[model samples]
Structure formats: structure tokens, C-alpha cells
Target: MEHPSDRPAGSHEARDLTRTLMRTEFRERRSVTTELAATTVRRPPRSTREIENSLRRRLGLGRLGERLDPTPWLWGWLGPLVVTALAAVMRLVDLNHPTRLIFDETYYVKQAFSLLTLGYEGDWPAEDDDENDAINSRFADGDYSDLVSEADYVVHPQVGKWMIAVGLRLFGADNGAGWRFSAAIVGALSVLLLARTARRLFGSAALGTVAGLLLAIDGVHLTESRTSLLDVFLMFWVLVGFWCVLRDRDASRARLAHRTAPIRAAEESRAFHAAADAAARPAEPDRPAEPDRPAEPERRGRGVGVRWWLVGAGVALGLACGVKWSGIYAVAVFGVLAFAWDLSARRAIGERRWFTTSVVRGGIPAFVALVPTAALTYVASWASWFAHPGAYRRQWAADLRAAGEPVPRPWLPDWLNSWWDYHLAMWDFHNGLRSEHSYEAHPITWILQLRPTSFYWPENEPPPEACGAARCAEAITNLGNPVIWWLAVPALGVLLHTAIKGRDWRAWAILAGYAAMYLPWFAYAHRTVFSFYSVAFVPYVVLCLTFVVGWATGLLRPPPHTDGWLAAGPAASSRRGGWRTDEPTRLARFLTDDGSVRPTPTAWAILLAVVALAVVAAAFWWPLWSAQPVSYDFWRAHMWLPSWI
Candidate 1:
């Protein structure tokens, strides 16, 4: 926590860079130009301690308690790895179960098959009531040409279908593993991605691992990971996009630092040398000429073509959108964040026109990097469809021209026109969908996971029958662990309040991540959406909640309070600023010896009790979450919350 002024100027690069970047941040703009200047600017480089101290002071976390970092060693990685491995094993074990298509897989799988044969989803026989009979006549005979002329209305995007088609192509459409392969892979990858993201955010590999483990063990995520549903793929890409954004943030700042430092030093040195030369020039040639000041350091570009990070951010966002249309939310939110980084950059350099520079240099280039890259990647996702002529919706443009209406746009190629038309149709279908579904979930309940969707149900298949138990045995339910979901409620409240208070940028950043994926759903809740859709942003929610818990536990320290009154108070304050002007703290301090206050062991025990309660709650709901078979009576006993039931 030593100040940068304590360090030599040569080694103060990191803090200087951060300061430079923060200078452009609108929140820090005034401070950039005002608070920091002259001798005070030279300090020993700030470390992890200094960073937290500044944040704690800014966010008023000092008034609450010493902040804590929740990066657990064993719990972080080992626990999460064990949980995730268990999930992976479970998914791979009964992977071929039922040996048949389940739920909406029929439509998606069939469409995928059609895409494989005809390069587009085709119309199915109007009266193929019996699936076996229809497959025998159509697919078995390889008569895919039986598809009708009309395009089928599909609600979701093609990226997911393209994923499905990959497995189908590799394993053939007839096998169980063929349809489920992509889901399993994406699910596992998400676990890995979550772990990495958590590691980065917490600066703890263990915390990252724990986050992944929690996600892996969670019933809903496990089930989706096992299933061939589009939502799982959507979650994977969205998480990947988020991780990339985080990387981009760190990288951009590093680049700004590298580029700005030498330039500043060199400028200072040159100014020194020039002034020395001018002063030494001898007034009226009477005095001996003083030696010129030494040459200044030269600054170098951090290495460039363009900022690769902006490009990376764009590509990640584009890939997210490619998976699900809802990924558009991430693109918009992150785009704003990236621009905010620009503002930080401009203000860091003391540029009066920081906003304008951000708009012209940072903002404009960012759009160029993000927009075109995303658009191209999104379009490229359709390569399979483009390669195959018979894919569903592939020939829409040809169909239009054949109907004798002039092709609407003469400036584009036929395929591009056809693709544009297909997008319009897809958009219409998604927006207009109002189909009633038995498991449709409301958007509001998504946060709490009320009424989780059941992905698999077996008739006459008790856990005993499936697992060979003497009694009802094992099952898999796609419900969240209740303790986690329940705690998230208060966690979310803490996040919202912190964001509004502008206490910590991390809190605000995490909140932005949630809003990107979740807020957009409120508008479409009337459609047949499900609570499972919230999985896309669940990792961020977990991170935000963890951050709050850490802050509450005093993992991160606030800025040192220079308030004179505290030292002047009659009651000695605690070594750490855990006690405030409150009655309880004051009383506790009054009982202290050596002017040092310490909470009793009993108080510490109470805190431990709260943690113990949360763990117990988690264990109680583990069965329901894991889909293990329990008697109906036992299941009812766990339903402490009526809303949960």
C-alpha cells in the first residue's frame, strides 16, 4: 500500500499508467486534472494494498469494515474441479439415455438434419404423426427431397443449429451422442471459462476454480450441460465474451501505460534540456555557457497496428451474438464500457478535449473494430448454410425472384440478399412468438429461479428403476441450488445499492454484466421464455455476490481515514476501522484495554454461525438440485419457502 512517491520514477510505471488511464475516466476526470500534480504525484508505486485502500475510501467501505478477499485455496480450485468433474462424469455416463430425442430436440435435431441434407431447414411431411414411421419413410430411405417448398418458422438463431449440425455431421443424425455432443462440449467449456474468469476477477486461481465448481454442481447448469439445448451454447459464448472483455480492459490499460510513459518522460527531459540550453546561452555573451541538460528518455508505441483488444472484444461479442440473438445485449453494454475506457485514456493525459478525443480516436476506432468484426463474424457463422444450397431459408431470395417480384435490392449479391431476407424472417418469428408452453417462466422469476424448467421426465422410471436401487433412487432435475439462488436476492440488492452509490467500479461493472443478459428478457417475458435463460449471466451474478460478501467480511481495506475527530474521541478506536460512531461499537471500544478494541470471541462465533447456516442450507437443497430421488414427503419438507415450491 506504499504510495507511488516512495518508489523511484523509473519503476512507477504501473501506478502512473493506471493514473493516466483513470484520468480519462469520467469519474476520475476531475481528480486527474485537479488532485494529482507536482511533488505529490511522485510516490512509491501502489500495490494491491494501495489499490484496495483507494477503492475502499472512495466507496466508503472503510466505514463498514475491513474488506476481505474471498480467494480460497482448496475451495477455489480443488472443490470446483471436483464438482465440475463430477458433472462431466454424470453427463457422459447416461449420455445416450432414452436413446431418443427429447422435448424440443425433435424440432432442432430434425432441422439440423434437414440443414445437413438440403443446406437449410425444410418443411416436414404434414402428416408424419408417427416419428418412427416418418423416419423410416423419409430419412432411412434418404428421401430428404420430400421436404416441402415453404420455409419453417424458427424462433431461435441458426448458430445453435449450426452447432447441432456439427455433431450430426460428425456422428450422423441417428446416434444419441450426435445431437448431444455440442451441448456437452460447450457445457464443459463454460465450466473452464467460468473458472478462468473468476480467477482473473478475484486474482485467485482458487476462487476461479470455486466459481466453476459451483456452476458445475448446480442442477440447472448440469442438466443444460448434458442436454442439446441452444441455451447452453448461448451461455458458453456469452461467458467467453465476458472473459474477453475483462482481458480487453486489462490489455487496453497496459497499452496506454506503455505508450504514455516514455512520451511523458522524454517530454520532461527535452523541456529540461531546452531550458538548460537557453539559460546557458549566456546573457549578452558575458557569462560562461552552462552545459546543456541531458537528453530525455524516448517513448515508444506499445506495439501497434491497431489495438488488438478492441478487435478481440468485437470478435467475442460477435461470436456471442452468433450463438443467440440475446447476445446483442452484451455487445451494447460492453461497447459502452469500452468507450468509457477511452474517456479514461483522454483524461489521463490531461487532454482538455478528452471526450472529443475519445469520440474521434477511441470511440470511432472502437466502433470500426467492434461493429465490422462482429458483423463479419456473425455472417461467417452461416458458412455451413452458405455452402449447402438446400439449407432452410437459404434460397429465400431465389424464391422471391421466381415469384416475379423484382429483387428488392439490386446492389447486393443474390445470396447476400437472400441472407438479409432470412434474417428479417427470423427476426419476425422471434418477436412474434407467443406460443404457450407448459414450462414457460416469467422474466422476473429468473433471478430467483422460481419455477425452473424440467428438461427430462421419464414415465415409470423412478430413481430405483434407473439406478437399480431397491427403492426409488437417482434422478437429475434442472433446478438451481436453493441456497445460492436465495442468497442471490440480497446479494443483488447489495450490488444495486453499491452501484447507485458509486462505491466501487467493480460492483458497477458486475452489475452491468448482469443487465446485459437479464434486463433484455423483461421485454420479451410475454413470449415462451424460461428461467434457464438466466444462466447466460449467472457467473457474473455469482462474482458480484462474492465481491459483496468479501467486502462485508473486510477482505479489502478502505483508504486510511485522516479524520482528526476519531483520534480525538474519548473511546479508543479499534486498530482496524471496524467500529464506527454507532452505539454497539462505541460500547465495545469502551471495554478495551491499551486503547485497542477487539470483538469478543462470542461475536466471532456468531459470524461463523451465519456462514455455517448458509452451508447447511446448501446441503439441505443439494438433493433437489442434483435430481436425486427422494420420497414425495421428503421433498415437501425441504420446501421452506412457499415461493420456491
Candidate 2:
């Protein structure tokens, strides 16, 4: 008997596991790529040609053809640690600000308190406006249980509330720290997640660190990181789902390597045995042992391991949906992307049944992972509601059952029925939510952050009385840092070019994330919206910007003759190259080939300039972004544009 250690990597059990993953990967890749391709429209300048050029020239496309050589230190564990530390500092600093309900926190916080007290969100009396306000204000003194009875019609999902409840449980419901815990933790983790993703995609620590820092500083992200809202939670889970899908891709590839070896070995052995038997046939013509024949219905590309990651991805995406219905978009996008990766793997191995096996092996297993896992997670998210019959919409199942409509007995369960009813009610409320308000915003302005939501407004105390200035205003506004956001517009252009021209999968990944979080809001322009919702996409935008900056810096090269020329160029540009006898733009020629900037002298200048600009910008916006008190005139002066006012 063979020892377990001595057993071939392609043994039956191993192959079985690989086959399972292979099947899952095949369909997942197709689904994700097709959806991604559909959502993407190739515009001019950043079209297919641009992608080709970026790959060939900018990022060294040819090198990939030789070997799978990843930069060693750049992609290892160190990048994540650095990124995580920076993210934690940015998110954790002065986290317990405002010390009161802000914006939609008035709704979500109360809902969580109600859930905690009575296991449901009880209706607030419209008549006792002052009483309700008093109760809300005196958060610690209120009888929270008195707020519940029948369920309140909430527009958002239970998952976000549950997350908020966890924080409330830990830090006490009255604390601002409790309310903002969900966003802060999720946002910090997002920085770490994006950092790891960038390192893996770009193979550079500098790039990864830049990505993390940019995300850490983005205004929208910063605000979300300091708030208790469902959007931030939505962002967190969608990112988690994305990461899990990537893991599934890698795991599937590893499985392929393990499963293919035995088939190759067996085929080679059979061929050698047949040739020998043929050579010795003359010695015994009457009766001889039959030559070895290859196994019938040959296996497809070596199987990867079982696709546990896909299942995990499904569960994560499901929880995302439980947080917000919009998460469905992410699920759809990632599902298709996972399958596309599988198809490419099979095609690379020259499998005859590449498409068939990809579909057969990858499709069903992917569904098994995604469909049921999502369904279950979504149901499970409503556990609190299910546990308490008095919770809003919890009795719908009982009401339906009492009506006795002879439904299929096997197809129905109380948990599923209650969850379904709750969703139907939630959907109805979301669709007809057309109420207008003083600050109600349209989604069209979300991209440019035209209409940011103001979260806090306290009674005026004089400058000295509060912090500073006359009538101090402690406000929490959802806005992104201009330096990061303004730069991202151009960065997005670069990333789009890189994705299409260079066929850089990393660029495509960023583009996909940005498109998913931002574009979906555009479809809902008629609905009341706010810039705060854009926080979900801020990390992607910052990441894209940082990546482009890193790319620009990474391509710098030394000039042919003058050392200053190399210093003049970006740090990462090619060190040697010619203009082919003709000059281009003065900026282009000086920067790219001539190498205008050298590390010795130019680095200090650039670093100083950048730091100075950052400091000045930060100072200018300090009063607004950080809730610093200033005169109304001073505040007006800071508002550069009419929209900002």
C-alpha cells in the first residue's frame, strides 16, 4: 500500500477535488467577463488600441510571455501590514466626534436601539414630535423597549443594523463610538484589502502603499469611516466578495497543476508499453496480453482543488445584499468574472472540451457555491427578525399560512416565507421613496460630489464657548478630498487605457469596481440621493489614482548623457530609449526619453513640492472637512464654487 505522503498528487481523491474546482472556475470566468465586457463601452483614445500600446510600451507586456515572474518583496506579506497600519491611524483618529446622531443615523440608530430593546423597530408617534425628539436626544435615559411593538417599514437591510447593534453592544448605545464602529472598522479593513489587491495586481510595494494611503485620505471614505451607515457596510462586503472571487481564481489554477500530472504520466507509460509489446509480437504470435489503452473519455485539464472559496464569495455577496439591495450588482459582476478566468485557463492548456468542460465542470459547481450560499446568508441575515414574531413583517408567513392557499408543501418554510415577505415590503418602500427635502440630491452630482450631505448641526455657542469663531458649527459632511478625487479623473483615464491597450487584468479589476459602485447610482437619478452614497466608490477612485501615480513614478529612467535629465522624468520610466529621429511634445520628450528628473536632486524637489501642496490644501479645507469652527464669512470664503455653498 502506498503511504499518504508517497501518493501522487493526481490521485483519485485529488483529481476529484480538482475536477470540482475546474467546473466551478470555467463558468464563473465566463459569467464575470461577459458582464464586465457588457458594462464596459470602449470609447476613443482609451479604446482597444490604447490598451495595446499601454501593455506593449508602458508596462512591459512581452515579459509576461516568458515566465510567471512576480516581484518578490513587492507582493509578499509586508505591503498589507504597512497599508493596514496607515489605514488604522487614519480611521481611528478622533473617531468619536459629533457625539450625536447625524444625517440618516437618526433613522438607523433608532432602528438598532429598537431592535435591541424589543427585537423590532417600533413606529414613532407623528403627534408627539417634541416627545420623540426628547427621547432621541436623551439616548441613554430612554426606555428602548417602549419603542417597539409591530415592525417599522425600514428601507434598508437588517445586516447593517446588526453590525451597528454589535458596536452598540460593545460600547453602549449612547456612545458615538458605538454608532460609528461599523463604518470605521469596515473602512479600515478596506484599506488593507485594497492594498493586498494592488500589490498582487501590480507587483509593487510602493504602488500598494500609495493605494492604501490614498484610500485612507479620501474625504468620502474618511466620513464613511467615521459614520454609522449602511453604505459603508455595503462597500465592505462587496469588496470582501471581490477578494473571495480572486481567491477562487488562484485556487482553481493551483488545482489544475495538481490534477494534470497523473494523466500525462499514465499516457506516457501506456505509449511506451504499447511500443515494447509491438516490438516483441514476433516471439509469440498465438496469444499475447492486450496492449494498454488510454482511459475512455479522457479527463479535461488537470483538476484544481475543491472550490470552497467560491462558496465563501457567495456567502459574502449575500451578506452584502442583506446590507443593501445594490450589492446584487457586485454579485453579478464577480460571478461572471470568476468564470472568465476559468475559460482562459482551459484554453491555455489546449483542452479539446475546453468550453464543454469549462461549462460542465465550472458552471454547476459555481451555482452550488453562489446561489445557495447567497440565499442562505441572505435568510440568515434576518435571524433577529425571524426570532421575534412581533418584529415588523415577521408575521407575514403566519398570515399567509392562515389564508391557506394550498401552496407546494415541500417548497415553503416559515423562515424563507417571512424573509420573502419582508423583502417585498422593503422593495415597495424603496421604489416609491420620492419624498423631497431641503438637501435632497440627485445621483448625477454624485461623481463630482456636487451635493454633500450635512450630518450634524448643534445649537450655537460663541467661538470661545464651543471651540472657536462666532456660533461654532460642529458638522459632519460627506465629501472626498479634492486632491485625491480630482486626480482620479485623469487616473481613471490612464487605468482605462491600461486595461484595454495593455490588457492588464489589474486595470480591468479597478475599472470593474469603480463602474459597479458609481454607475449603478446613475440609473437611479430620479431618486433622492446624496454625495455620501458615493463613499462606497471612493476607495476604488483613490486606488485608481494612486496606482496611476505609482505607474508614472515606476517608469522613470536615467537620461542618456545628463544625469539631471533622468531626474526630470518620472521615477519608474524606462531608463534608456530613443525618439526615432523626431521630437514629440516638449513635456513628453523631456520626461520620457530625455529623463529630466534624477533621483539624486529631483526627488527632494518633487517630494517637497508634493508635501507642501498637500499641507496647503489640507490647511485650506481644515475648517470644513474637520468641523473646525470659523466665522460664517470665513466659511463662505472657503467655499470655492457655488455648488459647494
Candidate 3:
């Protein structure tokens, strides 16, 4: 400023000139400087850092610069562990108290024990005979000698039973703890998975922990965890698949950034060189020459490829299917989600013909990655049934051939034919299950926890020492916490609006998962369904609710400074200063905020209140969830609605 060249080397003016010169040099020789900057840049642009950080976050690796500081990641895992421990205690405590099969446990528990003893499920004697009760008692007493060998015509797939079989094999299938052990363990682990998944989705460890806490205390999840039910396992695998797909999304974006960065650098370098060459030469009036054209940058091959996380999703989806056929809906939905993500990523990178390129290049690879892996994994889940000739319908093809009946698909192997016929029969059973029951609920009612299924209710039970009344009731009801489930209704509405209007990828992902698990049931409205089935999508419900809570608590927004501006300092102030003061902040604001200041106390207070209410509701309903002895009057007080009765 005071004859800048005359300023001292360390003066502010000299430093400014140095910075400008360095920036110009780097910009001009972009290709040559790109490798140097990538290797040595002390601080990269926010967008670049975000792309790289997203990949690391998905892999459960914290920031690259924070490799030496384990506190952030250490606390991340520790929080989930603490929440999972609480979940485990809630699910595993007094697991053997009931000492009897409850509701659908009458079907799955026995089938699991049979799967452990025989290679497949075995039929129990008719319910009208006393032998059935005797078999139940003997099985409970760890005696299996009287069991029949005939194969059972089970309606569901075998993965869930196999999961139950693991516990039975470990604990001798004599106690409720033995049959329900796997469900309890998987249920607790689901809390862990959901916490970590929410952390990545929302970029907040506190929000993730809150989500885990809610799922841990929700009565429906608690009861399903305590009981041997397929829905819990289905929930676990579906959540796992959802988590995998999210990771794949992060990894794909990071990969695309890395692959395209070089092309950008090359183009910038050619442009700078061409401009310099033109400026250095003087034009001659007599002989005017054409200006030099910048050489085109070499094209890089298609950068995106099949992701391993997608493969993991396919496997998880397959396992989900192995637990229940309803999982196919998720597989179909997520397959489309994967393709859409690829298309959006390509379009974002300014690629021409992105739609065609994504479909031709990314879509085919995704299909190959997901479908084959899922199909193979699903087929592998039936290994026990396929290996055991005593399984039901194992001889259908041979019998048809013996009877001179036309063999459907005669070219197929006998085992495959039999497997196909078995699947058809199972499909028929599912579609034909219109029999009515007291606890049966429509899919519409499931979101509101209406008509919760009664898993256990003891008859002629005397009052225990804890009960003040003469008559007492012991029951397990698959109800949900009213505060959390009811709140999810409005939260979901907000999520839909945000997803559509703002084009929020996170909202869309959460909505896709919710729709996959819930909307498919609408098509089967005639079939008998229960409120407990909603457990399969409970994580999404919690996610939606947590997202709203995050916004309300200002966790999703930058804290305003005392001067009524964002605390993001000069950079964010300059960019956002143009926005009117009353205008709503966008979710993308997180990308620019410094994230230095902690969220205000009000945000923490709101989160604490939500958690506290959820815990209180869980405790008030624990007697019903755990089938504990309570006075008839006390039980009646806990039923908040007539439908709950």
C-alpha cells in the first residue's frame, strides 16, 4: 500500500501480495499443483472436505485430521454401547418369568426347537389332544424324546427360526430365556446399529443416542425383543440393509469426487496456459492469426463402480427375506433407491447425458451387485431345508413324476422344482390368511400403535405379594410409547415435505425405508396383521422424530451470536449475510458452519425432556411389557385407550 515493493518482507502488504501470487501460480498451473495440494494442503475447501469426510464417517472412521484424537470416535461408540446395555437389560431381565410360550411364540419357539432337533420344522400333535400340552411341557422341561418326525408345513421362511435355533442349541430349549435369547440379543444390537446409523445420517452423536434410547424404551420393541417373534429379526436385518445402503452412498460420492478432480484440474491448466500465450503475443494488423484453442483434457473412464456396501445391503436384504417374505418389498424399493442415487450423483457432477450414463453404467452394475448377492444369500438360508429330504414338499417333484402328472418346468432340477412348489404353497397361505382375531389391526392403525397384540395373559392367577388386590393379572402387551409413536405422525409429515420441497437426501432415504416397510402392508389389508408389525420400521419412525427434534432444538442449525448473526464467523457471515433476517435457514447451512460452539442449553433441555418422558412411559408400561404380576385395577389404569384393552 505504501509502495508495496518497499514494504518489509514480513509486513502485512507483502504477505498479501505473496498469497495472491501463490494463488495465481496454483491457479495457472492447476494440473501440476493439484497433486501437491491434494497431498499437502493444510486446509481444503469445505466441499472437498465434506466429500472426503462423508466417506470416513460412513466407515466409522472419524476425520482424517483427527486420527490422533480418539475422543470423538471413542465417545461415539461408548454412547451406543451404554444405550445397548440398557436395551439388553430391559429385554433380558426376567426373560424366564413367564415360563410359557406367548402368542406367536407357540408357533416360532416350537418350530425353532424342532429345527434344532430335526433338520427342519416338525409338526406338533393336534391342539385338541392332551399330547400337545404334554409335548409343550416336556419341551419346556428339556425332554425331546417324544417328538414326532413328520415335517411341518410352515408358512414363513427359515432364517428367523435358524436364529432362534442358535439360542435353543446354546440353552437346551428348556426355558423362555433359551428360546427368546436370540431375539433379545438381536434387539439390543439393533439399538446399537440404529444409534450409529442415526449418527451418520444426522451428523450428531447426541441425536443418534436419543434415537437409541427411544427404541430401547418403546414398549412394542421391548416386548418383541423379549418374545420369540420374527418381526424383531426382520427389523434387525432391514435396519442393517438400510445402514449399508447409506454407507454405499457416502462411498460412491467420495469416489466420484476423487475420480473427477483430475479432469477439472487438467481443464483449468489448459485454459490458463492458452490465455497466457494469447496475452504474451501481440497481434499484427497485416497478418491476423486465429487465437489458440485450449486443448481438451483427456477423458477419464467411467469412475463410479459397484460398491461393497451395496453388496452388503444385498446380503442383509437377503437375510431379511430369509426371515420373512415381506423383506422382498425392501429389496425392490432399495434397488430403485440405489439407481436414483447414482443418477443424482452423476447429474451433480455436471456430467452430460447423466441419466443415460447412470442407467447404462451405474444401474446395471448396481443390479448385478444387489440381485445376485441377495438371491444367492437367500438360497443359502435354506441350506438345512434343502439338505434334509424329510422337509415338507421335499418329494413333490418325485411324486409328480411317479404319478405321471405333468411336471411344471421339467428341465429344472427336482430340488428346485420342489422348492418352487413349496414357495407357491407358502404364497397361497399368506394370501389366504383372512381369519379374524381380536388383536388383528389394519395397516392404517399400525402407525398409531392401535390394537396391540396381547402376547401373554395368565388365567386364574392369584395375587402376588406385590399386588395389593386379591386378583392379579400377568400379561405381555406389544404396545408402544404414546409420546414417541404419536409424535412420529407429525414428524413424518414434516419429513415428506422436506424431502419433496428441499430435496433432502436424508429425508428421502428415511421416507423410502418407512414406505418400504409400511406401505406394502396396505396391499395386503385383507390379511390378518398386528400393530407389532410396525416394529420392522420403528427405526425410521425414530429417525423422523429425531430429525424434527433436532430442528426444534436447533441442533440442525447454527447458533446465533449475540449480534444476531451466525457464529460461523467471517466466511459464513459473508455468504449468508445476503439472506433476509427472517428467512428460514437451510439444512445445507451445516456445510459452512464452523461447528465450534456447542448447541445452546435449550436444545439439550428439549432432548432430555423427550428422553425422560420416554423412559417414564416405558417404566409405567413395564408391568404389561414384561408380563409381571399386577393388580387388576392397576392393569386397567395402564390401558390409556379402549383399543389398548
Top lDDT: which candidate number?
A: 3
lDDT of each: 0.61, 0.64, 0.78
Candidate 2, which segments miss by more than 4 Å at Cα?
1-83, 128-131, 140-146, 265-299, 400-415, 459-471, 555-623
lDDT of 1 by residue, 425-535 (tens): 778888888999766789888777777776655455475554444545334446776656667689888767655553444566677788898899989877778887877
Going through the candidates in the order shown, the clash numbers are 39, 53, 0
lDDT score for residue 474 of model 2: 51
Q: Give the residue spans of candidate 1 off by over 4 A.
A: 1-84, 126-152, 166-175, 274-305, 459-477, 556-630, 634-645
Q: What would the per-residue lDDT of candidate 3 be over residues 1-645, giving only the tens digit for each residue?
A: 365546787788788887677666655564444444344433333454554454334323345465322443555677778999999999899888789776788789999888888989988866664666667777788787766799999999999999998998887688988989999999999999998898777665667788888999998899999999999999999999999988887677667656665566556555555565555555453334464566755543355666899899999999999999989888988989888877766665556677787888788888888888988999999999999999999989988999999999999899999999999999999998999899999999988987888988866675566677777888888899888999899989887766765456677888988888999999999898778999999999999998778766655432221121111111221221222234223322231122322444675577678888888888899999998889988999988889999
- Candidate 2 lDDT over 144-172, as tens digits, reads 54463667778777888888888888888
Weakest 10 consecutive residues of candidate 1 by summed lDDT: 564-573
Query: Roughly what TM-score does model 2 have, to 2 decimal places?
Result: 0.74
Instruction: State, as a TM-score between 0 and 1, how close model 1 is to the true structure.
Output: 0.71
Off by over 4 Å in 3: 1-69, 127-131, 286-301, 464-466, 557-597
**TM-scores, each model vs. reference:** 0.71, 0.74, 0.83
lDDT of 2 at 107: 81
